[model samples]
Target: MTNEQKALITATVPVLKENGVLLTKHFYNRMFTHNPELKNMFNMGNQQSGRQQTALAMAVLAYAENIANPSVLIPVVDRIGQKHVSLDIRPEHYIIVGKHLIASIQEVLGDAATPEIVAAWTVAYNQLAGLMAGHETNLYEQQTHKTNGWTGWRPFKVGKKTPESAEITSFYLYPADGGKVAPHQPGQFISIRLFLPQLNLKQARQYSVSSTPGHEYYRISVKREKGANLDTNGMISNQLHDFINENDVVDLTAPAGNFTLAPDIDAPVTLISGGVGITPLLSMLNSLVENDYTHPITWLHGCRDQSVHAFRNQLNDIVKTKDNVKQHVFYNQVTDENREAGVLEGYLDISKVPSLNLQPNAHYFICGPSAFIQKQYHDLVGAGVNKQHIYFEEFGPQLLSLN
Candidate 1:
């Protein structure tokens, strides 16, 4: 809002446009070189995949756009706050990042890096830093004070590994410290941190809690990352599948995420998921069943085959126990003869989605690959679903745009 702030934002626009990628690269390099400890805080694989780079670039642009009207950027700030908390990003780290970032800009701009330019950037950086610091503080405070299943990383030990299919496995996690765990609402995600030996880095990934919140333990179903071929395995997921085992201790950041079940018990709920995207919906369904909510619930899940379908038995059990819950499975590749009889034999046709027992005031939750979510999102919106009522989560870096 200040003239200095306006000047700073104005001066940085051309620089960011011209050398954003280079600045990001240099900034990260400098940051990691100076604070090797931070290497553990970020996803190296995401860095290599160029996801982190793009996210930073986008964030800077967003910040610049909202320089005069920072309030317009609160949602962006809130999301970044959640991510920072999930990653255990602290205020001190911001200072470090800012220093390195300014140095990188100076290194890039050379003689053009006048005192005024540096002062403007300094003010801008301080303003952003204060914003981030406040956001993080509030998040931390909430996590600390909240009684229900919301909190920072808690120690959990693996209880069971139930095989969902060839590529998918479900993990039951119980608190290792014997502390009370908060009950999470359906459709929320928990951030899991793993110290990978091979990569020598602490990597974090968000997994939808597959079980209802009232249970004694948390469950997450993960699909093993089958690389494009033999060349590119999903770094965090594959490592978890291969290395994690029953009784192993894991750290889980509190149940956090905005995607959640509809609060109104009267509103119809439709869950659409693809492959392992079924994790969150399964949790919601279980919650609905446990709480005996009378709202009609339809689960339309798409997978390759029965072999890869997660929670087949559990879903069947729900259909049997809950009159309000219905399930439709689509198998892209069906090999099993007996169980494959009534299963639809292709991907979900988004156009036909609206005809699937949907109610007029239905709320929808969708999770899958970027393409799947995007296609279904368009289809749902096209079918006159209120955009506010539709919630979705994308599996990987491809979903960054949604963030």
Candidate 2:
């Protein structure tokens, strides 16, 4: 970029950081006012709840941070593209967003918005928009490719809903169209979109596939998110728990996620999970068992209690049937008399992980709520695990905690 452009971007950074919320608010207001149709494209509830505001501010700040080195932002761009694809966001919509954003900046900055500033922002917006457009185009093409079995919103019927515990349910989904399903790598997640009748808006969430890839159907184990004390219940998971039923059609995008089991089975694998985080790990374990990958595997799972542990029978079955698999369960607040004895009864301690007889080259995968995932990540790093070998999937946005 030119010096002039760099200066303009640098100047805009403080301006944005100072008035980002206002800019986002104005941009959305102007955009929706001018093109009301876009109201359907965005999550109004999220907007009202300030999530959209925060997301927009974060995106702008990130763009500015990577202005001089756009390549560093590719992963962020791809994630946004995936979310856009899930929401049916289009290229033309980006142009609309760009126009409103520029106008909003001009209006907010007034005299400070000089010709140089305008030109710089114009170039930056176009560059980012081009990236978004191209990435989204590729995502759209990949989704629609016939060979990929990933086209938009395939109908998957709830073939089975097994209540694994009081708080968790395992859903088996089969293609309603009877089309061949694509085999997913273990540890990948599928995007699920549901239309909220009450709100008249669409919402999407990602769920890890709990079953092995070779199955004719996909299975997801969801833990119902009852509000913790005074906290609000998770909207999507609660909806799925209360209203979703057998034979109900769920719209699903093809499995997509960065976390995956390594193809090489030569190295030992350690799978650590907490609560519903076990979903993706279960898929990885099942994959290993079904494919007869001979590498030793250690699976450590921690949950509140036996009553909320999903796939208990299946996991036990795997351990009983496969000599290569080792299972360790840690139950917190276990009260059931029928529960097994000698199970560790507390949260997973990071110090215990290194004692699992893992080799230096062993690959580790962790997934769970943000706090659990972050703690585990820190622990794994502290335990001298190779950063490249440790993978994680967080159930919610992994925002930096201000506190």
Candidate 3:
């Protein structure tokens, strides 16, 4: 962009921050009204809960805040690119979003949005879109060419659905075409789209592949969401739990996510999770077990109680069989058996667990509630673990910045 445009964008950063949500909410409304087809591409549950608007607002403000030096946002951009690819978001969708976004700025900013300002924002939007499109294009090329990989949405049938815990259920999915499935890296997720009868529209949701890779079927463990939180009260989750059934078919994009394990890395690996965040970490742990890995691996988890702890026996079996694997469990409710059996009380306080010693070449992966991930990330850093080795993925829109 020109220097004048850059200066103008920087000058509007405060205004963007103040009215980001208002602008994005308006943008979504305008986009949906004009392009009703997008109703199939976005999570209507997030829209209802206002999470998407808030997240978009923050993203817009962040982009405007760093208009001069976008390189600093490359990591975030790559992360978003992975998600977009998972949802099969194409260049056309970006065009739709851009038009409405620019219009929303004009509408929300009103008299403050002069022609010069609009042109500058147009340049800024295109610049950011170009960066994201480039990253997504590369990702699409790499993924579609990989063995057994396919682009866009593929049909999958629910072979079986088994309840794992009080709130979580595991769904075993087999491709409807009966073709081979790609071996995805542990910790990656797949975007599943289904028709919502209530809204009479299609919506897509991302769920972590909770099973070990290399199997004929891809498994996703979904926790039925309810209550006020957007993560739990998701319409898709409710649809899966209450409406969908075995033998039901759903559409899904290929497995995609940047958060994954490097199986070839000789470093020790530590996996930590809270509540339903265990899904992806479970995939990692199962991969280790399936491969008979000899590396020192530690599994740490926290939940409300034993009844709510999904895969408790599966983890116990690993602890029993894997010589190099160590496990620790923390319960919110302290109990006599929990104490006698070595389970700790409250959250997984990393400082209390010395068994997870800071190995020089160890890598740490965490997934959980935003607050849980943040606290564990800080604790991991405080425990002498290198920040570079710490990797995390939140369940919902990212609310915390590790840097």
Best by TM-score: 3
Query: Which parts of model 3 have CA positions greater than 4 angstroms off?
Result: 228-233
Query: Could you tell me the C-alpha RMSD of candidate 3 in Å?
Result: 1.9
Model 2 clashing residue pairs (backbone): none
Ranking by TM-score: 3, 1, 2
Q: Cα deviation in Å at residue 184, candidate 3?
A: 0.7
In Å, residue 99's CA in model 3 sits off its true spot by 1.0
Rank by lDDT, highest first: 3, 2, 1
lDDT by residue (tens digit), candidate 2, 1-403 = 5877977787788888888888898888899899977665576655666667777888898788678888888877876776677666777888889899999889988999998898898899999999998988887787666354665678899999888788888888898987667777798878777776665656676788888885388888887876543112256677788899999999887876657886765688889899989999988988888789888898888888887888888888989999989877788876555345546768876565445674556888887767777787777777677777777776543343311
In the predicted model 1, the residue pairs found to clash are: 149-182
Better of 1 and 3 by TM-score: 3
Flag regions of model 2 displaced more than 4 Å: 16-52, 107-111, 146-148, 228-233, 264-266, 335-340, 358-360, 398-403
Model 1 lDDT, full chain set: 0.77
